[model samples]
Target: MKVGLYFGTFNPVHIGHIIIANHLAENSELDQIWMVLTPHNPLKKKAGLLEDYHRLHMVHLATEKFEKIQASDIEFKLPQPNYTINTLVHLEEKFPKHEFSLIMGEDNLKGFHKWKNYEAILAHYHLYVYPRISESTIPEQFKDHPHIHKIEAPVIELSSTFIRNNIKEGKNIEPMLPEKVWEYIDHNLFYRK
Candidate 1:
């Protein structure tokens, strides 16, 4: 199976995330798109982050009905401060027969050089980059790299932070979130101060 690993904190799964995942699965060579929920991302701030299981559940709720998208807690059992290189290596070892590709946004590509073992990631696995509004251009050096491919997948400007801020401000978040995920947040009173 050729899988596209879409990694994120997914503090709360929003429609934008689901859209990107579906677009990649339908438009790319990937047969499956896994929403890899990171327990702790070293590069991001920890403040306001929901518990791992809560975030994981939100991803599950958002993607449950999608045939191609899956919510994964693969990083929960892995070491803290999860690194992409380590997770990719582990996945390769666990599923030798499956081909894994990294799915990310164009914004991430700007900081690609800062990631740990980025060269190895570039060499070993294919990178399928979706366009984002900001910093949409790929660096010159990687523009023609065989393993790196930029895909024009449909994406929304909506972000998890925007959703959270809307919720906190008592604005209707139904428009920004998947129905199931909004229901889960409403029922559980999640992200309330």
Candidate 2:
């Protein structure tokens, strides 16, 4: 099985996330697209992040309907400041039959070098990049890399930050997220700051 690992905090999975996952599963060579919910990203700030379990549940709600798309909390059991390379290594050990690949946005590529063992990631696994609306070009260094492939997945300008802000301001985010996810957030009073 060829699995595309879409690593995220999923701080609250939104439509944009589903869109990308669905696009990759349907249009790409990947058989499955797992939304790897990272409990922590070493290079990112954890200020506004919700509890790991809540974020994981929201992802579960958001992706429940898709058979090919799954919500994985594998990182939850891993060490803090979870590194992608470490997770990849663990995944390979656990799922020996699956070929794992990394799915990321072109915007992330700008800072790819900063990630731990990024070179190993590039050398060992395929990277499927979706273009962000604002990032018009791939970095010069990776423009011709055979392991990196650009995917023309439909881009939704909606962001989790935008949705979170709307919720904080008491705005309706029904259209921005899956119905179940919004209901989960509302019922649980999440992000009601």
**Whole-model Cα lDDT per candidate?**
0.89, 0.90
Per-residue lDDT over 82-152 for candidate 1, one digit per residue giving the tens place of the 0 to 100 score: 78999999999999999999998888888898899999999899999888889456778788899988898
Sequence-dependent TM-score of model 2: 0.94
Angstrom error at residue 132, model 1:
0.5
What tens-digit string does per-residue lDDT give for candidate 2 at 1-193?
Answer: 9999999988789999999999999999999999999785556777668988899999999999999999998998898867899999999999999999999988899889899999899999999999887735667888889999988878778788988889999998898888998898999998888
Query: Which one wins on lDDT?
Result: 2
Prediction-by-prediction clash tally: 0, 0
Superposed model 1: Cα runs more than 4 Å off = 41-45
What's the lDDT for residue 124 in model 1? 93
lDDT agreement of model 2 with the native: 0.90
The CA root-mean-square deviation of candidate 2, after full C-alpha superposition on the true structure, stands at 1.8
